[model samples]
Structure formats: C-alpha cells, structure tokens
Target: MTDDYIYHVDGDLVPASEATVSVDDRGFRYGDAAFETLRAYGGTILAWDAHLERLERTCEALSLEHGLSAADLRGRIDETLAANDLADAYVRLSITRGVQPGKLTPQPDVEPTVVIYVKPLPRGGLEGDPVWDGPATVETVATRRVPDASIPAAAKTHNYLNGILARVELAADSDEALLCDLEGRIAEGATSNLCFVRDDVIHTPTTDGPVLPGITRDIVLELAREAGMPVREGRYEPADVLEADEAFLTNRTWELRPIATLDGRAIGGGPVTDRLAGLYDDRVENLCYE
Candidate 1:
C-alpha cells in the first residue's frame, strides 16, 4: 500500500524504492523480461502453483536465469503480502535479464532481477455481476498480435508493444479489442484469450497461432470439460466469432466476460457462455478460500 515493503531482488529483500536495476539492463532498454499478475483472496494467493509454472515456462523460453527456485519465490510472495498487510490484492511478479552494459548479447554473469509488488485491485467492472449488462462489443485494431516466428506467442514476455497499441485503440471505441494475425485469422484479444460458443461447443484459438495460453483460459477449458461441454482449439476468423451463438473473453483479471456485439451486430451471451462463466466463478471461489 505505502510502497514501504521488501522485494525479492537477486536473493535478498530490498526496499521497494531501492530495488533498482541498471539503466543499461536489457530488460530496461529492450523489454527483455517476463512477468505474471496474480490475485489473492481470503488471505491466500489464488492459483499460486499454476502461476509459478507459467512463470517458469516463460523464463525457460526466454533463456533467462531465475535464481530463486519455485519454493523460494512462493516464500517471498507470502512474505511480501504479510509485510504489506494485504490479504486481498494483486501481486506483480517480474523477472528481467539482469543489468548489462553492452549490446544485445546475453550477459551470463548478471543475475536476473526479480521484483514482487503488491497493489490494491483496481475497482471497475471487474467486480460487477458475472453476467454482462449488454452485448460485449469488439473493435478491430490496426495492430496485430506478434507472430510465433517473431516471438513465441505462448510466453508471457515483456514485449507488449503490439498489445498496448490494440488496447489504446479499443479503449477509444469498445470494451476490448479483437486482434488478428498477419493472415487475418482472429488471434485473440489484446490481453485475454478469445472463446466462442456455438451449438454448445466452446472454441478458442490454438496455441499454434498468435495467442497467449492464458491461465484463466486453461481453467475455462477444464471447467467446460468437467461440465460435459465439447471444447476445441483451432484457427478461427473474426467472422466465425461474430456468427457464433455466444462469445466471451477470458483473462486473470476479467475471468470470463460475455460478448454482446461484434462491430455492431447484436450477439447475446449464449447458454454455454453463461454456464461456463458461473463454473469459472465457482472455481475462483474455491481457489481463493481453499
């Protein structure tokens, strides 16, 4: 709250303000970092193990050194929450390619800079009822999600310029932006994974395309399977999403949001979306309290 807590830098707990990395650090200069945003509830971190697994995957994909083991990182997060006196808040865990003075070459001697910050959850539509008030609208932006060839789309890396641009454009017109790949196939939203319901089947873009395998997205898929709904992942076009019976977006922050409209057409949330949204909420409740 007051920014007066300890952060896990290298292997020590340093003051929030004093936890600084060199300006020449590649992460500072070129956005060479990987991070995750976790939610805490009922004095416990939600989905701690899944979040850490994704973080570890990101670090491995980027070839960055994460000095702390999974247990060590979890301990630091627990300590940080206690130090800040926060039970229900958001945790930002970041690891960057450590300080380096030279160009793009990887510096093996520099240890990765790990930072954990706790902040109050932003109050907006996120806490409202699970059912969307109206049809969720989507805006097509000029920017496209990064192609797999450029950077593996599955990893949650610091390179987010494309997503930032899409978000800016969407904020001006609609609640979220729908992104397409270079080939014009619907990739995903700026920050969340896209899911559509048609004929009681749930469909999402495949990892082979330009889409982040969101933690929340994975949960929804599991929930759908447990509920006996057919779910598949494959290439889909914006038109396909528009024509679906129901559509929604999923992410850690939003959980599951029903889509009401695409472009200007009215597309109400389908029974599948509604049921899945409820199921996802129940999962969250259990994770937060259990």
Candidate 2:
C-alpha cells in the first residue's frame, strides 16, 4: 500500500502516489467496476484461467465492456510484479467504467479504467507459513446477503457497501462476518467462502444463490471431490454449521483458515479441515512452487 511501489493505471505504469483518476469516473461515483484479488507464488499467478473467467463473468453482469484482452491484462500484472520485485504477492486488478455522463444510466460506448497493484506476502506452499495468524473467530451478523434477484451475486464489483456493513457488525475480536440470506440460509463470509464438514461430507452454500462462486471455493470443492471426499452444495441453515464437525473459510489471501468458534460456540476444526488444507497446499506447491 506504500507509495514506493509502482502501480499500473490506465495502461501506464506510474508511481502509486501519483496515480490518479478523474472525479467524474463512473467507477468512483457509482462503484461501476469489477475486480479480482489473486495470489502469486514464485512469480506465477495461481489459477489465472479461473480468475480471468470469473472476472469476465463479472464484467458481463455489469454490461461494461472494458476493451482489454487477457494477454494485455496479464502483461500489466506481470510488469507490476516485476516492477515491485515481488515473487510471492497479493495482486488486485480493477477495471472501472470510465468517466461517463453523471447519470444512473451508463453510456453504450465505454472507455475503461484498468489498474493493477501488488503487495508482498509471505511464501505459500508445502513449506510456507499461513498468511493468517491463526484459526478465525467468526460472528454471524444481522446483515443478510443481497439477494441474487436484487443484484447479480456473480459480479465481483466495487459495490462493497453490503460487505462493509456486515463487517461493521462483527465482534471486536472476530475475524469474519457470516451472513445469512433472507431465508435464514447461510450464504458466505464478508469476503470469503464458507465450507463445513459433517458425517464426512463437505457442505457449502450453492453459488446459485447469493454466494460469489469464489475461485478458491471451486478449487477446494474439486480437490475434495478428486480426493474421494463427499461434497454437497446447497442451501444450509446456520444450525447446520453449528453442528458441523469441522468448518473453515477460503479466499485467495487466507488460502484456508479453520473456524475456532461460531456465534461464541467452540465448534473447532478437526482432522477433515487439516486434510483439506494439506490438499490445498499440495495444489499450490505443485502449481506454483514446484
């Protein structure tokens, strides 16, 4: 986050302190932007294809065509990493609907504002330390997920006020906010995906609902399935998680973090979480570190 690092803004590399966007930019005024948070290990961006696919889907949902190809974005990210001398890093790529008429309705013609920035993170692999300090303590909040009907949940846009409100309700010591849908079904954390183990089966809220269909969540599900673990995705109540044998959160930054307690109940993670974490590490090691 320091000004010392270089940032890529609108196709040009600029010093972070000097990078600026117009006040009339639609992304700033209306949160009309889509973005992705990615992890890099040994100079390789993990799950590049999956992340790109998700970004494209989000852009489609917004109906804002940012005229930049995958290779163009990739080159920018590569230059960012190289410029910052970061082998292992946290990368954020954002594309905004450019300055438009100061009206709610977006214009048909679009000039996009694209930016890529990265910050160093600890090494991540078989022999690496977790980016998170310890198991997370979570609190179920009153803020319900915005229903998919209201807003397409698939878009990873800058309109994060919902998540922000959810976080504001979290306990002072809590690491995440678990949001339920209007129907009282578990949705996801403020920024991470939820997964629990019960009767040796993994359960997660279906993306068909308000869940973000996170790239990390999809990878974990596939890894569990390929490892012969039973996995189910559907609507699950908060009680289901309360009674789960093991629970964990997944995101690009955290990778995986066990839940130490939920709603003040100590339903800590166990062997199942350990196994899945190991599998995820194996994946990272094979793909990026090996």
Alpha-carbon TM-score of each model against the true structure: 0.88, 0.98
What are the clashing pairs of model 2? none
Superposed model 2: Cα runs more than 4 Å off: 1-3
Residue range 1-290, candidate 2, lDDT tens digits: 45478999998889888889999998899999999999999999999999999999999999988889999999999999998888999999999999999999999899999989888999988988999888999999999999999989989999999999999998789999999999999999999999999999999999989999988899999999999999999999999999999999999999889999999988778888999889999999999988
Tens digit per residue, CA lDDT, model 1, 1-290: 56576666666667788887778767788888999988776567767888988888888888887677888788878887777777766788888987777788787765778778876553222243432345567776778888889888878987888888888876554888889999999999887788988888889999888788888899899989988899999998888887898888887767788777778877767688878877766776666655
Provide the lowest-lDDT 10-residue window in model 1.
122-131
Clashes of each: 2, 0
Q: Can you give the lDDT of residue 139 in candidate 2?
A: 91
lDDT of each: 0.79, 0.93
